[model samples]
Target: MIAVRISIVLLLLATLFGSSLYWLIGQFPGFVVISLGTTALQFTLWTGVLAVLALWLLFRILLSLIRALVLPGLHLSRNWQAKKQHKNSQLTYRGLLDLAEGRWASACKLLTKTAAGSELALINYLGAAGAAAELGNEEEVNQLLALAEKADSRNELAVALTRVRLLVGKGDYEEALPMLELLHGRHPTHPYILSLLERSYRNLQQWDQLEKLLADLRANKVLGDEALRQLEISIRAQQLTALAKNLGPDMASNKQALVDLWGRTAKSLRSVPVLIAHHAALLSQLGEPVQAEKELRRAITKGWDKELLTSYGLLGGELAAQQLKTAETWFKAQPDNPDLLLALARLCQRGELWGKARDYLEAALELDSRSEIYAELAEVMGRLGEHDKSLQFYRQGLLAVTGGETQLMVRA
Candidate 1:
C-alpha cells in the first residue's frame, strides 16, 4: 500500500511538471541539436529531455541484469568455503576426541583423512602418528611423523619429541637415544627435552650420562623433589654396581677404584640407604670385608634401615661374631622387625650355629612368611637333620614361586 501511494504522488508530480514544461515551451520555443559523425539530428527542448530520461532508464536495467547474473555465484563460492572450513573443524575435533579415548584405529583414519586440506595439518599428522603407534603400525607412524615435520619445520622439536616418546613407550630405547641426544644438544633447557632424554638414558642404563644430566634437571626444575630424590638413589646405586662389574681381579686396585669413584660423589649421596647398601655389597664383592662391615655398621648407627641392618648381617666376614652381637643388640630395639630377624638368621648361618639360625628363621617366618625366609628355614632344617620338615618348607617356597605372594604366607 505504501508503494502504491508513492507511485500516485509521483504521477501527479510528473503531470504538473509536464504542464509547466509546456507553458515554458510556448514561451521559449527553443531547439536542441545533436551531431553523430556524418549525421545530424534536431529536437525540440521537451523531446531532448525525454530522450535523456530514456537513456538513464536503459542504463539502470542493464546494471540490474549484470548484478542479477554475478552476485549469486560469488555468494555460493563464499558459502562453500565457509561450509568446507566448518566441516574440517568438526573432523579435527572428532579426530582428537578419538585419540583421547584410545580408539587408535578410528583416530588414525580420521586424523589422516583430508589432512592436506586442514588448517592444522601438523596437529592432524602428529595425532595420526600417535594413533598409528598404538596400533603397532611402525611404517605408518614414520610416514605420519615425516609429514608432520614437513608441515611445520619450525616445530621440529615437537615432532622429534613425539617420535622419541613413541619409541620409548615401545621400549625402543636404543633407537630413541641418538635422536634424543641430538635434540637435547640444540634445546638444552627445554623441560620436555630433558625429561625425554632422562627417560631414554634411564631405559638404556646409561647411568653416567644421566648422572651428568641430573644437575641440569635440578637447575631447570624438570623433575619434582620426590622423583628426583628417588632417581638419584637409583643412579648412584647403579653406578656403584656398574663400577663393581668393571673391576679387575687385583683386590688393591679394586679397593682404590671403589674409594675414588664413591668418594667423588656428594656426601649426601653417600648417605643414601640404598647407595650405602650397594657400596657395602661392592666392598664385599671386592674382598674389602672390614670396610664393607664398617660402612654398614656406620649407616645403621646413624639411622635404622631394615635393609641396611639386613646387609650388616650378610656381610659377616672375619667379624661374624661381632656382627651377630650387633644385630642382636638392635633386636632389643626393634624386636618385631622381620628384616632384622632375617639379618640375625643370616649372621647365625655365617657363624655355622645351625640350631640358633633355625630358631631365628622360625621367628622371622612367624612375623612375615616371605618365600626367601621359607627357603632359608628349609636349609636350616636340612642342616639340623630334620629331613621331613625341610621338605615341607621347601615345597611351600616352590609353590610361592609359582603362585601368588600370599601363597607362602599360609604354612604348607
Candidate 2:
C-alpha cells in the first residue's frame, strides 16, 4: 500500500512538472550556453537536466551488472577457505589425539604437516615437539620447538615450558637447567615454573640449587608435605655422601665437619630414621664408632626403627657389651620382631658368644625363615662345633632363598 501511494505521488509530480515545463517554455524560452574562445555550445535548460539524469541511470545499471557477474566466484572463494580451515582443524585435533595415544611418529607427521595452515598452529607445533622428543629425535625436537617458539611469541611461556619439559623427559637435565633458571627469573611465583626448576635441579643432583628452591617450593606448595620431607632426606643423604667423598685422612677435621652438619640440620629432620641411619653408618666408616654407637643409641631410644637397630649391632668400640645390652633391651619391647632378633644375633656374634647367637637366630627363624637368618645360624652352629647341623642349616639357607617357607620335610 505504501509503494502504490509513493508511485501515485511520483506520477502526479511528473505530470505537474511537464505542465509547468510547457508553461515555462511558452513564457520565457530560457537557454544555457558555454563559450570557449568564440566556439559556443548552447542547450535548453530542461534538456541539460534530462541529460544529467540519464547518465546517473546508466551508472546504476552498470554497477548492478558488475555485482551480478563477480558475486558467485567470491562466494565460492569464501567456501573454499572455510573448507580448508576445517580440514586443517581436523588435522590438528587428530594430531593431538595421536600424541595422547603414544603414536609419536604419526602425531609428529600430521601435526608438522598441517601446522603452518592450522588455526591452532601453536598447539600443533608444541605437540609435534613432544612427539619428536618421545621418538628420541633430538634434532627434530630442537627444530620443532624452535618453530613453536617462533610461530607464536604470545605463548612464550608455553613454548619455553614445553621445551624445558621435553629436555627433562629425555634426561637432559644439564642442558635444561639454564633455560629453567631463566624462566624462573621471569615467572618467579609461577607454580609450574618452580616445579619444573625443582625437577631439573633434582635430576642433575644440583642439591645446593635445589636446597635454595625449597623455600619457594614450600611457599607455592609445589610438593606435598610428605614429598617435601622425602626430598629433605634425599638432600641430607647426598650431603653425607658428598662429605664422605671429600674427606681426607684427618680424623679430627672429619669429626668436626660431621658434627657441624648435624647441628645445622633442622631439628625435625634430625628425627628421620633414614638420615640418622646414614649419619651413623658414615661415622662408623670414618673411624668414629663410639660416636656412631651413641647416635644410633639415642635415635633408637627415641624410636624403634629396624634399620637403626641393625646399624647399632654393627658398631664396634669399647662399648661392644653396651651395644649388646642396648639391643637386648629392645627385645622386651619388640619380642616378636624378626629384625630385632636378627640384630641381637649379630650383636651376640660380634661378642663371640656363638651359643647365644644361635639361640637368637633360632628364635628369629621360628618367626620368619629368611635366607640371612639361616645363613647366620649355620655360621653360629659351625662355630659351636655342630658340623652336621651346620651343613643341614647351610642347605636350608639355599632352599629358603629359593622358596622354603612352605616346604615340608618328613620326620625320619
Candidate 3:
C-alpha cells in the first residue's frame, strides 16, 4: 500500500517537472548543436533534454540486467549453506534423541557425521563418543574423545567426565578410576563426579577408599537420609568382609576386629537387623557365642527381626540353653509369634530335646504352615523312630514346597 502511494507521488512529480521544462524551453526559443565524428546534428533545447533522459533510462536498464544475471548464484550458495546448517542441526538433535532412546548404532552414525558441522562440536563429539562406547567401538570412542578435546581444550572437566562415564558403563573401572581421581582433584564437591568415584571404588572393591568417600558424601549432604543410611550399611558390611578376609587364621583377632567395628558403628546402623545378624554371625564364627547371644538379644529387644531370631537360635553350646531361655521368655509376650516358635524349635533341636522340638514345630505349623516347619517336624519324627509319621510329614512338606501343584512322593 505504501509503495503504491509512493509511486503515485513520483508520477505526479515527474508530470509537473516535464510540464515546467516544456514551458521553460518554449520561453527560451533556442537550439543546441552536437557534432559526431561523421555526422553533425542540431536540435531544439527540449529535444536535447529528451534525448539525455532516454540515455539515462537505457543505462539503468542495462545495470539492472547485469545485477539480475549475477545475484542468483550468490543467493543459491547462501541458501545451500543455510539448508546444510539446518540439516546438521537436525541430525545433532535427532542423534541426542536416539542416544536417549538407546539406539546406539544410529546415534553413533548420525552424531559422527554431523560433528564437523555442528556449532557445538564439543558436545557433538562427546555424544558420539558415548554412542561409540555403547557400541563397544573403543577405537572410534578414542578418536571422538581426541576430537572433543581438540574442539575445546578448556573443557577438560566435561571431556574427562564423559570418558569416565563411558569407562564405568563398560565395567572398565580400572581405567575409569584415574580419570575420576583427576576430576575429583579439580571438582572436589561436584556431586556427579563424587557419585561416579564412589561407584568406581565399589566396583574395584576398594572398600577403604569407598569408606572415606562415603563419609565425605555424607558430610556434604550429597546423599539423602535413607540413601546415606543404606550406603553406610553397605560400606560397613564390605569393610567387615574385608576385615574377615585379613584375619589370617586368628579367630580371636577376627572376633576383636568385628567387636571394635560394631562398637564404633552408629547406634542407628547397629539397630538394623541385617547388620545385627551379620555381627552375630561373625561373633559365632569366632567362638564368641555368648557375645553373639548378647548382641542378638539387644537387637531383638529394640526390634523383632525374624532373621535375627533365626540367628539367635543357631547359637550353640551353653549359649544355646541361655538363648532358648531368653527366647522362651518372649513366648509369654509373643505367644503366637511363628518366628519365635521356630527359633524355639531350632534351639530344642540343637539341644537334642526331641520332644520339645516336636511340640514347638507342631505349634509353629498350626500358627503358620510353612514348608520349613513341616520339614523340621518330619526330621524330628524320623529322629524319634516314627518312620510312618516321618514319611507323612515329609509328603506334606513336599506338597507345601510345590505349592500343592503336584505330589511327587509315594505313600510309605
**Candidate 3 lDDT tens digits, 26-62:** 7997889889988989989778888999999999999
Those runs of model 2 whose alpha carbons end farther than 4 Å from true positions after fitting are 1-11, 18-58, 283-291, 378-412
Model 1 C-alpha lDDT per residue in residues 329-399, reported as the tens digit of each score: 88898889888888889889888999898878878878887788889988888888888888888888877
> Which of candidates 1 and 2 reaches a greater lDDT?
1
lDDT of 2 by residue, 310-390 (tens): 777766666777888877877898899888899899888888988889888888887888887888888888898887777
Would you list the rank order by lDDT, best first? 1, 2, 3
Give all TM-scores, in the order shown.
0.79, 0.81, 0.72
* CA lDDT of each prediction against the hidden true structure: 0.87, 0.85, 0.85
Output the TM-score of candidate 1.
0.79
Q: Once model 1 is optimally superposed onto the true structure by TM-score, how far is the C-alpha of residue 350 displaced, in angstroms?
A: 1.9
Whole-model lDDT, candidate 3? 0.85
Q: Pick by TM-score: which candidate is best? A: 2
**Any runs in candidate 3 off by more than 4 Å, and if so which?**
1-80, 241-246, 369-375, 386-412
